[model samples]
Every structure is written in C-alpha cells, then in structure tokens.
Target: MTTKEIAQKYVELNRTGQHMQALEDLFAKDAVSIEPKGTPTEHAEGLDALKKKNEEFATMVEEMHGMEVSDPIVADNFFSCTMKMDVTLKGMPRNHMEEVCLYHVKDGKITSEQFFYTPPSMN
Candidate 1:
C-alpha cells in the first residue's frame, strides 16, 4: 500500500476501535513505537513489543469516555494526525489527552511511530 493508503487505513481502524488490527495489518515486523522520554513505555521496538505496550496501556484504562483519530496528513513516506482520548485511568481522574501521532513508512509499511504529548504531570 502507498503511504496515503496506509495512513487512511490506520486512522479508520483507530476510529473504529480496531487499533490492534491496524498494527497487525500495517506495521513492519521491526516497527518501533516511541513514547515520550521518561514514560514507562518510552520505546517499544518490533511488532510484538508494540502489541504488548498497547495491551499494557489498555489495562491501565479504567474507563474510556471517547476517542478521536483525525484523518491523516500524508507526506512522502510519512504521515501525521491528531489523536484525542477522554478517559479515566486506573486510580486517576478522568482526563482529556491529545497528541500528535507521527508515522514513518518505508517499503509500503509503517516502520516507526512517535507521539508528542504533554505528560499528565505537566498538564
């Protein structure tokens, strides 16, 4: 798939609550997920690690009020979109989290994804 195709499919999957499916279908075997420095999951390399990271995060959510994934803005082998989630995490107050999700695609598959967001402590 082209970068635009992959980006669009990714946004669609996230919007439809099929995040795991998106990862399985679009990511390269050695894809990497990069969270902000100092976070518990600062880096998850390889598809399996990425999947585990997502599962661990899901376990931390007490309630998901809503989620929104914007249409992607694609630019030659890269894409970006805004993601927002309203949720209450385990032992934490409900919060609105927003981030810029950037992805790098190579050879028609997503190779890396990095998210930019303010830490809850900084919010």
Candidate 2:
C-alpha cells in the first residue's frame, strides 16, 4: 500500500472508532510516537511502547464524549490530520481538545507520528 492509501485507510478507521486496529495493522514495528516538549511523556518507541502509551492514555480517560477527525493531507510519504476530542479525564477538567497529528510512512507502514496539541495546564 502506498502512503496515500494507508493514510486513507487510517482516516477511515479512526472516523469509525477503529484506530487501534489501524495502529496494530499499519504501524511499523519500530514506529515512534512523539508528544510535544515539556509533557509528562515525550517519546514512545516501537510497537510495544506504543501499546503501553495507549494504555496509559486510556487509563487517564474517564469519558470520551465525542470526536471529529479531519481529512488527511498527503504529501509524498507524509500525511497529517487534525482531530478534535471532547473528553473528560481522571482528575482533570473536561475540555474540547484539538490535536494535529503528523505521520510519516515507510514501506507502507506508519514509521513515526508527532502530535501538536494544546498543552495541559498544570495548575
């Protein structure tokens, strides 16, 4: 599958709440995920680390009310999508959050993801 094809399938899966499946199927074994600087967790390397990171995120979510995913913009082996989530986390106030997730594909699998999102308040 080409990058555009993978990105299309990824977007479709995410819109249908099947993003975890996409991750398992389309991400490379050595994929890396990066969060913005100054966050509690910054980088997650490899599929196992990705799964652990996702588990951590799930543990923090008290509720996920809704989510909206944007169409992916593709360029060569790169793609990007923006997602808005309405969620409430354990011990945190509920908020409408937006994140721009950028991805790079190699050999038909997602090789890396870097997310740009609103930083959480520590107050």
Candidate 3:
C-alpha cells in the first residue's frame, strides 16, 4: 500500500473504533511509537510493545465518550492527522483531548508514529 492508502485506512479504522485492528494491519513488526515526554508510556518500540501500551491504556480508561480522526495529510512517505477523544480515566475527571499524530510509512507499513498533545490535568 502507498502512504496515502495506509493513511486513509488508518483514519478509517480509527474513526470506526478499530484502533487495535489498525495497528495490527498497518504497522511493521519493529514499528515505534513515541509519546510526549513526561507521560507514563512515553515511548514504545516494536509492534508488541506498542500493543501492550495500548492495552494498558485501555485499562486506565473509565469510559470513552467519543473519538474522531481527521483526514490525513500525506507528504512523501509521511502523513499526519488530528485525533480527538472525550473520555474519563479511572481516577480522573472526564475531559476532551486532542492530539496531532504523525506517522512514517516505509515498505507499505507504518514504521513509526509520534504523538503531540497536552495531557489534561489529573486533578
């Protein structure tokens, strides 16, 4: 798949709440995920580790109110999109969070992904 194809599929899966499926189908085996500094799961290397990170995150979510993913902007072998989610964590108040997600594609698979977002205050 081309970068545009991968990006479009990713956005479609995410918009439909098929995040894990997207990861499984689109990411390379050694793909890396980078989160903002100071976050609990700041970086995950390898598809397995990324899957584990996602699982752990799911355990922390009390409820998911909604999720949205914007159409991707493709450039060369890279693409970017905006993701917004409204949710409440186990011990935190409900909040809406938005993030810009950038992904790199190589050999028709996602090689790496980096996320940019301001985390909501736990209080």
Candidate 4:
C-alpha cells in the first residue's frame, strides 16, 4: 500500500478496535512501536509485542472514539499524520487527545512507528 493509504488504514484500525488484525497485516514482522511517556503502553517491539499492547489498551479503555486524520505528510518510505482520539477509560473521565505519528515503511509494510502527544492533562 502507499504510505498515505497505510497511514489511513492505521487510523481505521484504531477506530474500530481491530488493532491486532491491522498490526498483523500492515506492519512488518519486526516492526517496533514507541509510545510517548505517560501513555498506557510505553514501547513495543515485534508484532507479538504490539498485539499484546493493543489488547491491554482495549481492556483499559471502556470506549474508543473520535478518530480523525489530519496533516498527512508522505515521502518515499516515511509518513506522518496527526490524529485526534477520544477515549473513555474504565474509571477515568474521557480523554480527547491529539497525537502525531511517524511511520517508517519498508516493502509496503510499516516497519516502525513513533508517537508524540500532548500531555494527558492538556487533553
């Protein structure tokens, strides 16, 4: 898939809580994911690790909503996008947050992702 398409699909996967499936299909076997400090998951390496992280996130959040794509920038093997996410934690108030995700693509699959987000208090 094209970088833009891959980025968009990632958002779609998150929105639908199909992250594990998306990870398996869209990411390279050795893909790595980095989460900014204070997020539920910190950093993950390899597809299995990512899947476990996604499952934990799904369990912790009562509801996941409000995913919007913005500011897509794509290059030869890299892409960045800003995403808005609304999540309702199991016991905490809902969070409306924005994050920028940078993706490294190789051989039509995402090989790495780095995330930067505003602090949770600002969300």
Q: Poorest 10 consecutive residues of model 1 by lDDT?
A: 114-123
lDDT of 2 by residue, 57-108 (tens): 8888899999999999999999999999999988889988899999999998
RMSD of each: 1.5, 1.1, 0.8, 2.8
For residue 75, give model 4's deviation from the true position in Å: 1.2
**How should the candidates be ordered by lDDT, best one leading?**
3, 1, 2, 4
TM-score of each prediction: 0.97, 0.95, 0.97, 0.81
lDDT of each: 0.94, 0.91, 0.94, 0.82
Residues 1-123 of candidate 1: C-alpha lDDT, one tens digit per residue: 999999999999999999899999999999999999877799999999999999999998899999999989999899999999999988889999999999999998999999999867523
Clashes of 3: 0
Clashes of each: 0, 0, 0, 0
Q: Which sequence of candidate numbers ranks them by TM-score, best first? A: 3, 1, 2, 4
Please identify model 3 stretches exceeding 4 Å from their true place.
none
Question: Which residue pairs overlap in candidate 1's backbone?
Answer: none
Query: TM-score of predicted model 2?
Result: 0.95
